[model samples]
Target: MSFIRKRRSLVLTSTLALSILFLSLIAVMVGLLYKEQKNAAFHGFTEIGAKLSAQAQVSSNLIASVAGAYENKQNPQAELVSSLQLQLNAMIDDDNLTNAYYMSTKQFEIDGQPNLITMIQSSLSSEGSNDNGTDYPLDDVFLDGYHRVMTGETLLTHAYSDDIGTWISYLAPIKDDQGNIVAMFGLDYDYDQVKRELSALLWGVIGIGMLAAAVAIGILFFIIRATVRPLGMLAVAAQEAAQGNLTISMPVTSSDEIGRAAASFNDMIHSLRQLTSSIKQTSDEVTVSSLNLKEFANQSSQATQEITIAIQTVASSAEAQFSSSQETQRAMTEMAIGIQRITESSAIVSDLALHTSERASEGEQALRDTVHQMNSIQTGVLHATDTMQELQLASGKVDDILTLITEVAGQTNLLALNASIEAARAGEHGKGFAVVAQEIRKLAERSRESSDEIRTILQAIKEKTAAASAVLEGSAEEARTGTELVQTTGSSIQSILASIKQVSDLVQDVSAACQQMSAGSEQIAATMVEQEQIAKRSSTNSHHVAAASEEQLASVEEVSGASEQLRVMASKLGEAVSRFVI
Candidate 1:
């Protein structure tokens, strides 16, 4: 295949491959990001649930402790219940609990008054059949626990939902001196808070993930266009040069991979130009040699025809010479001189062919050297392409790591949220824990942001690496085709050399025969002038043959010089291409 076509193929294939790789990286990053978001969401939900559960437990414990304090009769009725209720209400008000309440099964009065207890009873009755006349479910668990308190049974049921919210209701039975329950107390937590926090966190993470993805895609697109496009241009240029179109120039004008590739392409073009020029020069010389050979052959054919006519004349003379033998001998001697001249011309042709063969051998050696250098360049390009591929793979791995980091950040955020909820529920006692929760959440946010940055950077690296790989692959393929062309030229030179060698051997044999012919032609007086003329013609042909040989030698030298220059240029191109490492 022609170098140009191979180079174009390489360019197209490399471009497509790079594009695919870049897209794949983006897809992998996006997938990883999505997974991280999902993990974060789940983790956030779990943490939120656990925090809520912890807060609820702590609240429940506080309610039980306060209830125990109230039952101990540490002070008077109004003072203890009123102060205790106020404090318990304050606790619930300050935290995330659904409700906190304490009620007595006995006649508990406000402000140290008896009739007030009756009024309170009447109020409770008016509100509901359970807690006065209220429609809301009002259970006097203290009344139910009256007998259980003596049995030391404090009922704590599983969490449930009420008008207030989902809650874990704790029942701590308070007993009198008579071992009868007097009051019951508990608090209800706002269980929905966990779900609310989880929802909020989920949305936050999703928003960040979308933003990151958008940024990454944008960056990748920019990088691919900026970097890959130039590389493609360089590849095209290289292809053109390889095809013997040395005027091709790369459009990429940057200091990056594209720029380097373009420069290398230019260098390769220069080399190819020199190589082609040499080959053309050699071919021109060969053409001139062929013309010389054709002229020599025509001359020899004419001389042979003249000799044949002269022989006919001599034979006729010989038949007529029964009357005069001298005339027959004279004609015969002239014909022999003509034959000697023809033999000498043939000898000159043989010498020219020998010189041509030697020149061809030299050309063949130069072509072989050029092919070897091109092969080395091809090998270097292949290695460079492999290195670029490895870089792209490494970039992919970095993207994966970013995804993992993002996921962990999300989980950490969830944990912080849960801790926050727990601290809220803990009220004044949980204040220190709330600060820790806040810090953790901040750290998570930072981590998420960092992962996003990493993903963006990795995406850029992936794009650049992919582009580099594409350019390298294209260059390698072009070099391979170039090597093949060089090899082909080398083979052609060898063939020409072999043909020349045969011609040279024929010429040497003809030279020996011509000497014998000249010696045999010496005795005929009438043929003497003809013999000298043939020798002169032979000498002129030999001079022309020598001139052609000199031209062939000069052409061969030009080819060798061009081939050497090509080798140097290819080496320079390979060196320039190597600059993109890393």
Candidate 2:
């Protein structure tokens, strides 16, 4: 009953439910069978009563026909009445009837109503003693059967309960020799006796059913227990696992669903064991890694502080370098401008010297043409008076050419001297300028000496030509020498022009180098300015980075503490899982 209200063990509940159901079914079957058997027994008992009624009816007809007892109505026949009573008692005894009796078809008036009278009855009849004539009331069921039997029908009644006992009745017609139904005979059956026998049989069946049900329940209990035992073990293992004992493994005894469940449980336990082991290892690793990370954070913080200080120092140095570079750039720019002016001045002087040399060469060429004309004229005039006049004109032209060359050499020497002084100011940047200036000065000096020699030779030629034709031969020789001297002087002037050009070229190169150096110094100044700004900004940013590193170091310390706690938890988990038996 408690199992019915709440959950119980699987085997126990199942056995009880199945056993009860079987017993109830057997009870229902037995009840139905007993009902049918009791009904049929009642019917058989009624049939036996009918047969006895029929025999009593025949005996009555015999008495009526042979003894003429019933034919003589309203007349007493003692021997025949006794004989009929004795025969009815014999029918009652033979059939084990509650009573047997006969009733006349004739009605007798009693208490202002005509009623059928009991003609005869057995010793068992409770109708006031074995009666020869006694009034009897017929109820509906009895009345119907009585009328039917008087019409020569034999029948039985359904079982009914009276004051004495439960009973069924049989009715038959008694006929005389004239074939008229004179009386009807009835016999009552003991219906309760039939029910008693059936009740006994039903009790026997119920006893057997109870024993069989008990045996079946026992068999079912064993079967269910076998089926559920593994499940019970699985439940115990599950409880252990719930208690943090993951090491337990259920033993699998069968290949059924419960056994497979047990095997799966074992696999789960193994997986959990492996997972917990990994957690422990990982916690240890996390602890070590946290310590390392904390140390790294501290080192990084210190390095950040050092970097901040270093960046401040760099910023100061960069500012100083930037100021120096600016000064250098401005100074170089001024120097470049001065060098450029010097180069211009050198170019102008060289151009003027070159123009002077060209003019001297033109003058020398003009003198040669004039002298050749004179020689041609003189050859003819060697015997004439105008030859000396032509020779004197040629000598004058030669003297003019020599004076122009000397002046050109003087101007070139002055310009070269100026270039040498300017080159000295430019220092190493103008070394080429200095070497070219020295060469120009040497060429100019040599040109001036050549010009003086040419002037002396030309004066001698002029005087000798003035002595007339006697000295004409000597005059021609002197003119030829003067011509050679003029040619040599022209070569010297050309050399001076070339050396001046070289000086101009070298000055240009020095100017360009100075300009390049100026530009380079300016770029260096710009780079230094940018580097100074970057260093200042870097110093500021380094402070921020150092602050962040301090924060990071603090976070790393927290992580180290948390990792230590995690290691402790992992240790506890390992200890918990170690309790189960695998």
Candidate 3:
């Protein structure tokens, strides 16, 4: 059953068994005492009867004279009976013999067998007996004593019962002048009085035994209750512990086993409480980590999407740049052909020289258009460079965030390590917690590794973006040089028109300037091609970075999920431990 009940039962059973054993022992001792007292009382009565019988021997002469008179058919004088009664009366004492008398035996026939008759008796009798001579019963014990007395032997009866009362009779033989046995003197003691005393003693012993049993029962009850009381408290404490209330304190009243067990129980509860508190703290940390990781994952995902869009824009810009470079090359080829035609006309006629001036004007206008296009290309390159710089800044910020994440992961790992150590210190009870700590440590390591990967990708993106910016700047400078060359070509064209009257000398110069403009256009096209290739590479790197970011984000999400699970597990553990009151 319940612990308290079992304890109480055990104690009660032990007490009862002991009490029964004690009572039985006391009963045996009392019975023996009563038997001894009974024997002593019987012995005392026998002694008193023998003493009175000896005292009656003093009247032996008178008793023999009376017997002689009675045997001759002569009535004994009243004075002899009176004298015998007076002497016997002197022997009679209070609380001793009940009767003392003398009797003379005579031969008679009974059923064809010889028998003895009492011819004379003392006049004295106990207050309860008849004074007149009366025949005594011929029982075996009485006859044996009487015969022994007739043979001059002193005898005591073995206590007999009759109509008058229970008694022990003692007999002493009366002798004649010739020393022959003629009569017996007897004394009877009241055995009934001894029986009453013994009965009283027996009752007293019974009363004492009953009192002892009662006292024993009371003492046993007190002892059992005192012993069981502590156990009851312990049982209550255990019940409270079972109900998850560890706050109970037991009183250590003694250095007994129960007290020691209570102390140990309290210690256990305290330890469990500490472990629970640690688990709760760890759970809170894990929850915070999960939230932070989730937020970081979302931010990283957004950053990657932004990077993807930026890369797509850069790719578009690079494609436009490639197409623009091709157009510039085509325009340069067309300008070279026009320059060849102008050179051919210059050798043909001076009258054709006006037409040559008009062609030169048109060529100057084309050169101005080329300058404007080059300026526009320079502006686009600068704008793309600025955009790339902004993307690089963003990547730098992401790197910083990753660094922070790595630091957090490291801190979390340290915390997990500390927790694991504490769990190890807690021994077997904390094995589950140690496993949880190990899992948390693993998650933290994974997080740190993921952060490292993200940092690496950001570093690559930063390098690629820087390279792309430098290329864009170089391309812008080349475009500016091309614009200046186109402006110089336009200026040379104006001067050639002013000197068209002496056009033949300036023809070679004009051809050389056209070739220079063509070379500059080719250089500009080469620069644009280089810028486009750089932009394409930058776009590819950005795409790689974006993909890596996505992967890192996924890893972060996994870490976050793991952290969340860890948090939940810790919470469950805490809740489980919380069932204890402590």
Winning candidate number (lDDT) = 3
Error of 2 at 170 (Å): 2.2
Question: 1-582 in candidate 3: lDDT tens per residue?
Answer: 486687668667756765676567667766876787777556645555555555556666777878888678777778887767766665554564567776667655566544454544434454544343444445667778877877778766787887888888877777776888877777777888877877887787677666756665666567556745664565566455546565666777775444554554455445445543543444354345434434443443454354335445545676654454455445435544543543343244333444555555665555555556556666877898999989988998888889799779867876785676556547788899989999998999899768865664565456446645654575566456545544553564465455443433333333343344344434434543454567646455444444543453454344335434434543454454455444
lDDT per residue as tens, model 1, 125-194: 1232323111123334333433343355654444465454665444454444554544444444444664
Whole-model alpha-carbon lDDT for candidate 3: 0.58
How would you order the candidates by TM-score, starting with the best?
1, 3, 2
Task: Give TM-scores for every candidate, taking all chains together and pairing residue i with residue i.
Answer: 0.50, 0.44, 0.44
lDDT of 1 at 19: 52
lDDT of 2 by residue, 1-582 (tens): 443233235456666676666667677868886886676555655556555555565565554543244435564466667766666654553233667777777655567654686777776565546556667766567777877886778888766775767777888777776787767777787778767777887898678667766765676567556634554455455555645566667787777444554555565556445544543444344334334433433443343344334434444575554454344345434434443443354354334435544543553454355335434533543454466677799889878988899879877886786676557547788899989999999999899878865764564455334434333343344334433433443344354344434434443443343344344434433443454466555445434433443443343344334434433443443343344333
* TM-score, model 1 to reference: 0.50
Q: Which candidate is the best by TM-score?
A: 1
| Model 3 spans with C-alpha error above 4 angstroms | 1-33, 50-91, 102-134, 140-159, 170-185, 204-227, 250-279, 287-565
Model 3 poorest 10 in a row by lDDT: 342-351
Which residue runs does candidate 2 get wrong by more than 4 Å? 1-33, 47-68, 74-102, 107-167, 172-181, 239-243, 317-582
